[model samples]
Target chain A: MAEKVTISTVAQHAQVSRQTVSNVLNSPDVVREDTRRRVLDAIEALGYRTNRAARQMRTGRSQLIAVRIEPTRDGINGSVLDRFLHGLTDAAATAGYRVMLYTAAGPADEIATYDDLLSSYELDAFVLTGTDHGDVRTEWLAARGVQFVTFGRPWDNPERHLWVDVDGASGTAHATDHLIAAGHRRIGFIGWPAGSGVGDDRRAGWARAMRDAGLEPAAALDRQTPDGIAQGESVAGDLLRGDAPPTALVCASDSLALGALQAVRAAGATVAVTGFDDTPVARAVGLTSVSQPLAEAAAGCMDLLASALDGDHAALGHRIGPMLLQPTLVVRQSA
Target chain B: MAEKVTISTVAQHAQVSRQTVSNVLNSPDVVREDTRRRVLDAIEALGYRTNRAARQMRTGRSQLIAVRIEPTRDGINGSVLDRFLHGLTDAAATAGYRVMLYTAAGPADEIATYDDLLSSYELDAFVLTGTDHGDVRTEWLAARGVQFVTFGRPWDNPERHLWVDVDGASGTAHATDHLIAAGHRRIGFIGWPAGSGVGDDRRAGWARAMRDAGLEPAAALDRQTPDGIAQGESVAGDLLRGDAPPTALVCASDSLALGALQAVRAAGATVAVTGFDDTPVARAVGLTSVSQPLAEAAAGCMDLLASALDGDHAALGHRIGPMLLQPTLVVRQSA
Candidate 1:
């Protein structure tokens, strides 16, 4: 076995004091650039690794961010979170943080998991996803003064904490406007049942776009079901077979849009369809959809969390507003 | 904020010594069942979290498993890793471990990341994915005597380390056998370019199955291109347009099958197409695909890792053989 490399080895190799080596690894800014580069080179040559546990015990910062790995729901839409996580991991690495993943049954279970993580790991902060109205996870973290940021907006108290969200309403509105421009007068919407903040926001965008274009978004043309391709197909089949069937459909998700496309094909009807999230399935099937700037959102979340961890409470308070990124409308054959 | 709870607080509340509380949390087997229960109840009441950094400093076990989060490649097949990650997180929790994620450009970069993770975090073990011919990641970890397991087989040195792999050859063979049983004498294969262990394994299955059935596995009917829907479409289209084209196509991945499905539709050809991975896209499009038991594989990996960490070197040596899990062929309308 190879000899174990330690800080003393690195210091000896670099001809520096132990404190200088420690400073280079922990607080590089405090060391001279030449000295720091020499120490780093020696450490790299010796393959010296800092003991993070000891550092955490001293500094109370693990340089780890906790996030829940949600179960794969309807497989089609599940890729959205997967992509976001990829983006988050990349962004976190750039910010000198690693992502730690956990699985929980629901919000209550998630809160419990957070408690366990905080008690055991002393994680630097958390980057949460799937935020919704009456979210207990955010409240628990905020009450305990845990530094955190969410990928979704806090619907009830947007200003309470840092959050980065894509404008779903804007995304759906763009899809609707595109269809309206393409000579679709009677357009239908397929979405989840109301009460979800995200769902309501998406439906509102479709409604607003219709009203702006002086088209009636009649309740008859709007269909609601839990997000699924089969459900999308079933609901869309009924709408296509109904009186004054829609000339196009704006779906809340790629899963629903794929289903709607199937229904359109099954009905042998030419109905334009647009889906949200611009999932790969949508791309594979040539469906026009709305795309979120997931990488940007991830970077934004990291930036906000960095500020929160910087301990600049006054500046953080002033920067408490939500960061909403616009979604792009990806034009494809379906629309 | 409420008063901070410590080991001492739990000890006082449970009417036990601090060492007893520590034993209950770390080594429950050393404490009586009734005493462990009392300590746990007190912990629940006070919300006491173990200082993991201190514990790690004392025991050298962070109970963290590191895994690389690969970039989202060709969106259609990316869900496979996502599902695997979900499964791994769930299974790791059950095994009293947490999953930490990192990203790297390629094998060398991943090795560097591993060094960083090991030096700083002291991760208990790594769960690697995307193993292939001459995989340096596995070699580096093995050389260091790191406790780790891979979600892929080491193609070159199969018996060198611990791994859990889905039998890709068997999966494609089943798909081929299904087509042959349905009286499809001419079966075409669409896969990635040669040299990839996984792709080659999948192709080998089809060839073996064809020869076993006394059918000619002709080179003219086999095509290789990068894995993508468009690539699959282009390759499958050429095969379909060729002289005496196959009545069925077996693809290495769902993405390719999806493309082949498009080519079949475009050619107006009555062809059966099967995909591997049984990704959500395949399910949504009703493509027959091979499904790897991801959760079971995850559990298998965790079980092996737990054994490796249990310090039972003799038993672990006997259990060092690779765990090859069977893939289930999920039949749908595509085939």
Candidate 2:
């Protein structure tokens, strides 16, 4: 086996102290330009590898950003998170960090995984998704003084931390308005059961658009069920079979909209349908839906987290207000 | 800030040497069971987080497994990797390792990333996907004596390394057999262009199944195109418009199968279609598809990687052969 090239070897080759070599690798901003260049040259010439573990022990930074890989539930909407992850990985790479993935059964299990990751890997920070009402994960991390940025806004406490989210309410409202402009008076909403901040926000968008247009956003026209294609089909089927069936339906998700489309076909009714998320499924089936700027959202998340990690006092204090990006209505055949 | 818990503090509390504490954390098998328990207890009591970098410097192991996050090409088939990633993370956590993600533009760029990740992070091993003929990434890692196990088989040199792969040929053959059993003699195959090892394997299955059923696997019935829903739809539409179109179509991916379903609908023809991957889109549309046991495949990859990392001489030398898992056919309404 070849002799191992250590930091000491690089230091000797560069005619600098081991501490100088360490500084060149970890905190290059602190090292003199010439000295840093000489150390880097020596490292390249001698094939010296920097042990990040050693750097972590000295600097308490691992350059690792942890994100929970949520289980794929109802495959249609699942791609939404997957796309965000791809965007996040790309953004993190550009910012000189790597994304680490962990799995958890739920919120509590995710927290335990965070604790394990913190103790074992000393992750620099976390990027959380699926934020909702009273999310204990954020509180736990904040109390422990761990840095984190969420992809979804903290519904219960928006000012508590940094976040990047798409304007879901505006998205649904736009969809409803488009249907209304197309001369549909009786519009129905298919959404998840209330109490979920995101679901409620989306539901409100449809109702707000209806009221603004002088159309009654009747409770009888709204249908609430769990988010799934089958559930959407069942609920939409019920709505279609009811008295004075809606001429247009705005769904909370593409999965629900896809199901509603199937119900429309089965019943041979010409009802316009719109979905949220604009998932690939929506594109494949030509469903008009809301498209979030997920790549921008991911980059925004990295930006907020990077600022916090750079020891920007204002960012660390959560003074950088949450970033809310607009969603666009991608018109397709369904609506 | 609270007083930091160091290894020395844990050693003092456990009444053991610092080296003993280190051994308990990194190589507990070498430490006495009773002593290991005492050190662990002291670590928990004092909330002593293990400095993985310090441990890495001492033992040359970071307990990190790196994998390249492939860009989502066609969103339909992209979920396969996402599901595999989730499963791999779950499996790695159970094996005392973490999965780290890096992105690269292509094969050459990916190898460059491997070098940077290896030099900076000292990643213990790599988990590779999308293996192909004459893959330079494998050669580079093998030459440098880096430990890796591919999620795909090394088609050019099967004996050179460890791999875990789903039997694509078996999957397609099973799908073909199902179509044949249903009394369809003229069956067509929709697959990627022929040089890809996986695509070729799947194509061969359809031919083999046709030949076994005492039917000529007509070249006219086979169509090759790049993997995409639109591509699938166009090619299937062409075939459907041609003379003597097949009664059943088997696709290499769900994306293609979905397009074929659309083609059939457009032609107003009664034809059966089966897709591979059984992606959520497939499940949503009720397309019969071939499903690889991805969670099991992930566990298998981890098991092989762990065995290699355990310093098991036979495994390190590639004595343990590659693991070939069977794929099951998921029957749905499309077929």
Candidate 3:
């Protein structure tokens, strides 16, 4: 099926020449308002929106900020990312912005990859996702005077960076409080590795919540591991094997919560489990987790980067607070 | 972690260029062969390579070809497409091309999306995936003189297209032959809708293959249905439930094979199922299939595209045959 909203389809649907449709959208001053309305209605009905890539070439300034995405085999699909990315793309597109996806993988060829973009740069700015601490990629882009943004707090010099990170500490605090409110004092935490800035914030959020609740925040109650579905299960298994385990467990991500679910089932118990990043899988599997507006977060970062690209790095090092974003205690079978 | 491959890194490895390295590569007349060898050694030791995108940009050609991808959620991970895309990137990077991802979903707002790119072109051409018949996006690009290459033939006019198709007719024939060789005369086919040109090619291939084996292609052997994982299973289930069911089935894709697998298991009967595309699901379930050489196909399309972008469409309408990529019969318990 060759599915695309072609100009011809729009032309036929609007009962106008392809030239008229183009003229109406491109230079509306040349068309009458009545004719424009007919064309607009047809465009909307047939879905003949403008193509940004071509538009950006003529204008020499694009709202199409790019983000480097590298997903693993078992990771989330573009659709899941789209659920939020669409929100972001829509928000950007409506404002005349677009999100461009750049392939930034291959550790063995870093310099080669960066150097390739030196000529005829298309991205108005870039948002780096899955950025780790002390990331060379971020630094390389920074050196090139390219506008920069990161999904998570980048590993490099964070103080001088432009980013829009979730208030993880606050999100974890909310999750912990919710579990506590449910009459579960023996709260446990599942945090990610030290390298991830987002993970660290999440751990701190849990700790802050515990402190506010007048708990000691014992180290034994915290389980540190990599952010993965399998890792959560293995670690959760050990925690559940203990004679006195926490009644409610908080996880770093929905992916980890999936593993926690596995361990919960394996251990033959109903320990409440919660996670961060309420990914689509969480809903499919009914795992309650923190709901971060990933697309919104991505969009916020893009906005910041757009400004930065225009030499307004003043927003660099800015942080968006714990947006409760309807954390919707999704109260599934697991938690 | 800001990685910088300094001249010293290269020089220390080759004991050459604070300057001689540049001389050898940039102004060879200024450097002797012995010096060039020293500089080259340093480059090798430092893992230094030239950036193809940059070199191409110098000639107003970018090694980056944008692919408008629309990967869905649900069970579809776009893994096959991603693997293929990455393979193309790797291959193209070798020939000086990096793949950029563009999200052109529906016709609504994408026209502006294209318009935005004309002023800031970052790619030399566009490689379109997920295109259907009468795709306006393609036509729009063609109108604007944007060079594009596609994976499959468009429905309306295959003659005007430049693509590398899956050799569907041959692949379907192989799938049929595989079942026939395994002692199965009756073979059922689960495919996309009738009007779908690609699916029709597969059905026709099945017919030709069956005819070549002196077996009449029965109507009962073909079941055209909606495109999806569930539909594959449901249609295949219907075929299997009949009083006289085919001993083997040929499916359009691994996604459909997934459904077929479920159908076979649910019915408590075992029958062989072969699929096209040889997707990951097929590999996971060990289903017999006709493997499509995505990387090779992508490369061939890219070759034709690059030539066109270089102002030579002499080899348009070129059709590369299906890769007889040794579709392995895993001989698993079920299949």
B1-335 per-residue lDDT for model 3 (tens digits): 44545444565677764456545544567888888777766666655554342244235565657665553444333545665565566566556566655565565445544543443344577776655778787788788877777777776876555666666778888878877887888888888888777788878888998999999889877898876668888998999999799888888776777778778989988788877765534543457777767777777777777667666645442322331222333343334
Candidate 1, residues A270-304, lDDT tens digits: the string is: 99999999888788778899999998888888878
List, residue by residue over B223-312, the lDDT tens digit for candidate 2: 999999889999999999988999999999999999999999999999999999998778877899999899988988888888787777
Candidate 1: clashing pairs of residues: none
How are the candidates ranked when ordered by DockQ, highest leading?
A: 1, 2, 3
Q: Score each candidate by Cα lDDT.
A: 0.85, 0.86, 0.65
Worst 10 residues of 1 chain B by lDDT: B49-58
Q: If both were scored by TM-score, which would come out higher, candidate 1 or candidate 3?
A: 1
Candidate 1, overall lDDT? 0.85
| A-chain TM-score, model 3 | 0.73
lDDT of 3 by residue, A1-335 (tens): 33555556666787887667667755678988988788778767764444442233235565556654454444432323444444555556544565555454564355444443433244566666655667777777778777766666654555656665666677788888888888888888887876576678789988898989898678888999976777888999888888788888998777677778789888888799997766545644567777766667756765665555545545433333331232334566566
What is every candidate's C-alpha DockQ against the true complex, given to 2 decimals? Answer: 0.45, 0.39, 0.11
TM-scores for chain A, candidates in order? 0.85, 0.85, 0.73
Best by lDDT: 2
